[model samples]
Target: MALFVETGLKPLSANESYLGKKTKSKAYRMYENHLLRVLPDLPLEPKGKMKLTAEVYYSNKLSDLDNALKPFIDCLQKRYLFNDNRIYKLEVEKFIVEKGAETILFRLDPYSQEGDKDYVPHPTDDREHRCPECGHSF
Candidate 1:
């Protein structure tokens, strides 16, 4: 099943939160509030494997991608969209729109794995090729 949500509220950037002050948590709280007001109640089922797609119509082109993504994921977790750990895949894009409402549109899709062969090795592949010239293990 796929779920979609869209909001016109502008998101706080991680850069804005971390630039020079201790306002990260406070900004996140405000962002969360705005999202809660616009978002619908999430479904009760906890998704096991899902891909998240986010399109950010940014009010400012200076906003960092990762910064914009943080509070959104936090808000989703707060509203019980799904466990953060359950998100196996993520896709995010940012667009600059002059004289347009800033917004975030997202979709959650249940991902279907092809097979074990498609799974990437998680550092356990044992291909020791780090620092080959120096033969350093660090």
Candidate 2:
């Protein structure tokens, strides 16, 4: 299924501390509530490994891509009655846009390993590695 959200994505940050207990920031809480209100109901069946692809548009380039997934996935899990552990593949892309134009587009589908391949090595992968004990390249 596909879903689109018009509001800006909020990262799940460690910003709140109440008596040493962590709490979500007010902004994050508001964002979660907004998502719950706007997100459509999801099917309860078809439980299995799933794949999630998300295209995130941010107002600026200051946000880290990894931080945006948890909050959005959490909302999906809570509202859809599905477990996050069922997700076997996740792909996310980020784009920068003008303020107030931030949005997110995502899709969920059953995962298949048919086309999976081994990881490709980076260009620098063959470079000499440093020995942790001596801090010397070997």
Q: Which whole-number lDDT from 0 to 100 does residue 27 have in model 2?
A: 93
lDDT for position 52 in model 2: 84
Model 2, poorest ten-residue lDDT window? 1-10
**Please, what are the lDDT tens digits per residue for candidate 2 over residues 1-138?**
334332222444444423576678999899999988998876545677888899999998998887789889998887777898898788899999999998889888877666556323333447666656666664
lDDT of 1 at 7: 34
What pairs collide in candidate 2?
none
Error of 2 at 107 (Å): 0.8
The TM-score of predicted model 2 comes to 0.67
lDDT of each: 0.70, 0.77
Candidate 1 Cα RMSD (Å): 10.3
| Top lDDT prediction, candidate number | 2
Q: Summing lDDT over every window of 10 consecutive residues in candidate 1, give the lowest-scoring window.
A: 1-10
Model 1 lDDT tens row, 52-123? 789989879898887777678878877765676677777889998875788889987766555534455433
